[model samples]
Structures are given as structure tokens and as C-alpha cells.
Target: MPLFGQAAVDQLLEVLDLEQVDAAAFVGESPQTGAQRVFGGQVAGQALVAAGRTVERDRFVHSLHGYFVRPGDPTEPIRFQVETIRDGRSFSVRRSTAQQHGKTIFFMSASFQVREEGLDHHSPAPLDDVPGPDDVPTMLDWVQRYPSRAGIFASAPQAVDVRYVGVPGWVPPGDRVASEEQRVWMRINGTLPDDPLIHACALTYASDLSLLDSVLSVHGEVWGPGGVIGASLDHALWLHRPFRADEWFLYDCTSPSASGSRGLAMGRMFTRDGRHIASAGQEGLLRRIGERKQ
Candidate 1:
């Protein structure tokens, strides 16, 4: 089986290391993961890391809004420019732009706040009596069973270990129609340094995975050889509490709406112990094409 081992996780951590080019300007590199375009989650996470690097440690990121301006070229390095929008006593706002080949490819706005006691409340955890990661089918198991159909996944350098709770939506449907909801258990493949930003960035990378797949489930669009075509248009995330990305987290995802060649999916992240930690939403371009003739 292909390994998403310690080396892979370290490679991701290395990708987040940014170099300061000038005042408020930083440089980041894309890992050669053999993807056609840069992963949107990587850009979002790096931008947030850059923004956080410029702020005080006591202030943590509470929320972020980002747009995918253009598909990034994975072969080249990206430059991040951060703008300090505000720095009040309790809140700081920052804007980050990622540029490559002299063009803007992505941008994001993030807000950070100093920790304080507040009236805390959250929606009930959606997961119930679900099997844990050890009991689920890992991505490698799927790839091994249907190599011709899921070969592309095997080629990518995966930094996170993913175990789907049920058959993936992208798998060619048999008697069952695709489901509206999807669940997966995932965690960073290896231990990370004790840094909250690292954990946040790791989760940020994991967030983009399978979000649009929820949309695919609704349309019965499997991914491979002229299947569904899609790209994330915009993504938003709210961090509710501190959590370790290296530990197992259940990602419960669902597609609530699809219209005009677009789909909206939301996900809630919960610890194995059922602590609701974060919420995410994304809208993506989703279209179907005719099956390929072999």
C-alpha cells in the first residue's frame, strides 16, 4: 500500500514555511504533488498562516473568507502579500493575496481575536454511533480494489490518512444511488510540532478534500475519465475551539443546494469524543460530461 507517512506530513509542514520578501510580503512554495493545479486548501491555509505570523500569538484566527481567483500552477512558487486591515484591542483583520506568474490566483480575509470568556454555545454534534477510523476502509483499500478506476488517488502524495465511512460518492454506482451526505474520518498521517497554527493549517488543508464530492453525490457524478468536473469557487471556515489535526476528526459533509452549475456543501468537524470544533462551507463549479469511450 502507498504510504501517507511521516515524510508526507513533514513535506506539508515544510510547504507552509514562508519567506519574508518585504514588509508584509511573503513567499511560499507548492509541493510537487502531481496535481494539475494548486490545491485551494493549501493556498487558503498558507495565506492564513502568513496572516497569523504577522499577528500576536495571543490572538487566534476565528474566521476566514477566501476566493479562488485562478487555478494556480503547481510547478511554480507563489508569493503572498498580506494587508493589515485592522488591529483593534480585541480584534485584528488581515487580507492575503497569493500571486504566481505575475497574476493573482487567490485571496483571503481572516479575523483574529484575543481569547476571552464568552457565552459559548454550539449546535448538537451530528455524528451518532459511527465506526471509528480503524473500522473504516482507508483510501488505499479503495484504490487497491479498483486500481483502474481509482488510480489517480494512488499517484498523489497524500499527507492525511482518510478512512471513508461508506463507499465514496465518486465510486461508480451500482444498485444504490449516490447519497446526499458523506462522512470520513481523517487525521494528519504523522505527529506535528506543538504549534496551534500548524494544527489549524493542517485542518485547513483537509477541509477542501471531498467537500465538492458531496455535490457529486447528488448528481451521481463519479470522478474519473470524463466524469464530473468541478473546482472550488469560494470557501469559508469558522474555528470554534482548539483541536489537534493529527488526531482523528469526523468530517460530516452534506450538500444542501445545487443550481446554475454550482453546488454548496457544508461540513462540521468533530473530535472522536464528540467535541464540535469547526464548521466549513464551500461553493464549487460542478458540471458533468459524457463518459469516455475506452
Candidate 2:
């Protein structure tokens, strides 16, 4: 069974409730890879679950900082060890380390604050004049259109629905261009519970998709047979407000720098109404075939 499927993730969520410290130790193993690595979103989501379990229901997570150290093996179970850094009247802090085979694969620190009204100021949301997810073609539809490159989409986990305004590189150019920015509509494929922590985790998982590719867009390198190799090195996110994961969210991404075989990209996630819900930044290893020697 796929570790990233809806049923698998749902089952994993049941085993890894954040309230009990022992539940934090719950790890979902991949039946295919047999590697002990945990899913990046899973770790982020589970960590948020762990932190949320400790705080009052009214106080939601406002921000989180995490680092990915190594690829988790799916075969082995990941142990989530939690640390209560501080507890205060208005704020609480917690740190978690996800370990596999006794090796730390990921580390995270999250802060929660009691809900309070405050002055708000933010830049106007970007113009989403483009078509919405339903208006655009589903990623799966595109994959089927090009059966030869179906493996790429086939390998992706099915927890989220991805609709690309610009077709992925693997597909033959059917009205596509290499732009510095990429737009996509994303949301949980299924109805997610109202738990804010679950929404945050779902966002974290969705954040990683296509972020690095934004960097590739700058160089006109889309994923294909001759495309460059890219993998995320580090990911950071800041949640600004509360939102639903099951609803369509717009992700606008841009690449500011690509040098020394590394690319940096930043993203802003917004609700359909243009409210800024969260911000994300990532740096990754981008290397093109044959270009590495030159």
C-alpha cells in the first residue's frame, strides 16, 4: 500500500494523535520504498498535531520553523520526540525531532499563541484573473494526454489536487511558455476535518510541490527528459492566518536567484479572496545534466 495515499495518511493520523506524548512516536512506513524516511508534510503535519495537542483548542498555531536534514526511509518507523520549550500566559513553544533508525531526519520548532484580536495590515492579494482549478485542466488529465510521461504524475502522492496554469515540461508544448513565475490552484483532494492543525499540515505538504520548479522557470528548464535535477534542501513557512485546506488556495511562486548550482524561491499562499494566509521560502540543489561538468 502507498504510504502517501488518503487511506494510509488517514490511518497514520489515527495512530499519531498529538495529544498523547506516546502518539507522537507514531510513524507511517511506506510499503513500497521500505526506506524509513517520513513524508515531509507528514512530519510537519504530525509535528503541528503534537504541538496542537498541548495547547488549548482556541489557541491556534500562527507560525512554524522547521529544517529537513535527511531523506526519511519509508520502511522504518519514524519516532517523533517532543520538547516543551516554554509555556506562557499568551504563548507556548515546542520543538520536535523526527528520527528514523535512530538518526534524526527532520527537526522543527513551532510557537502557538492564545487567540487575540489585533490590528491587521497586509498588501493587497495578487490578481488571480486566471482560471480557477475547476476552470483549468486537472494534472491527471494532462498526464493522460501524454501517456509516455505518465510516470511523473503517477509517482506523486494523491493527498492533494494540483492544477497547473502552465503545463509541466514533460508535456509537448501546447500553448506553454517558460515564465519566471508559476501559478497553480491547490487543495486537499478530500474533505479534511476542521482541525486547524490538519489544515496547517496539509498546507505544509502542498507548499513543497512546484516551489523549486519556480526556480527552473527562470532558466526555462521544465521537467522532461533533458530537464535539470532539482531537490529541496530546506523549507520554511510562516502561517499568517487561519484557512481551510479543503478549499481552493492560490499559490504564486517566483525565483529570485539561481547560482552556485543552487536556486532560491519564495511563495505566497492566499485564499480565493486574496487574503495572505501563509508565506513560504525554499532553497534547493539544481543541477542540469552535462552542464555539471561545464
Query: lDDT tens string, model 1, 1-294?
Result: 344789888888988888888879999998875779998989999998899898989898888999999999989989999999999999999999999989999999999999899798777766666788999899888878777777547777678898888666557555225777878898999999898888888888899987777777776667655576678999999999999999999998999999888899999999988888999999998766663422
TM-score of each: 0.94, 0.86
Best by TM-score: 1
lDDT of 2: 0.72
Q: Which stretches of candidate 2 lie over 4 Å from their true place?
A: 1-26, 30-38, 155-157, 169-176, 290-294
Shift in Å, residue 48, candidate 1: 1.0
Error of 2 at 268 (Å): 1.1
| Model 1 regions lying over 4 Å from their true place | 1-3, 173-176, 290-294
Clashes of 1: 0
- lDDT of candidate 2 at residue 113, scale 0 to 100: 84
Between which residue pairs do clashes occur in model 2? Answer: 34-75, 35-73, 35-74, 35-75, 36-73, 36-74, 37-72, 37-73, 37-74
Model 2 clashes, total count = 9
Per-residue error (Å), model 1, residue 232: 0.6
Specify the highest-lDDT model's number: 1
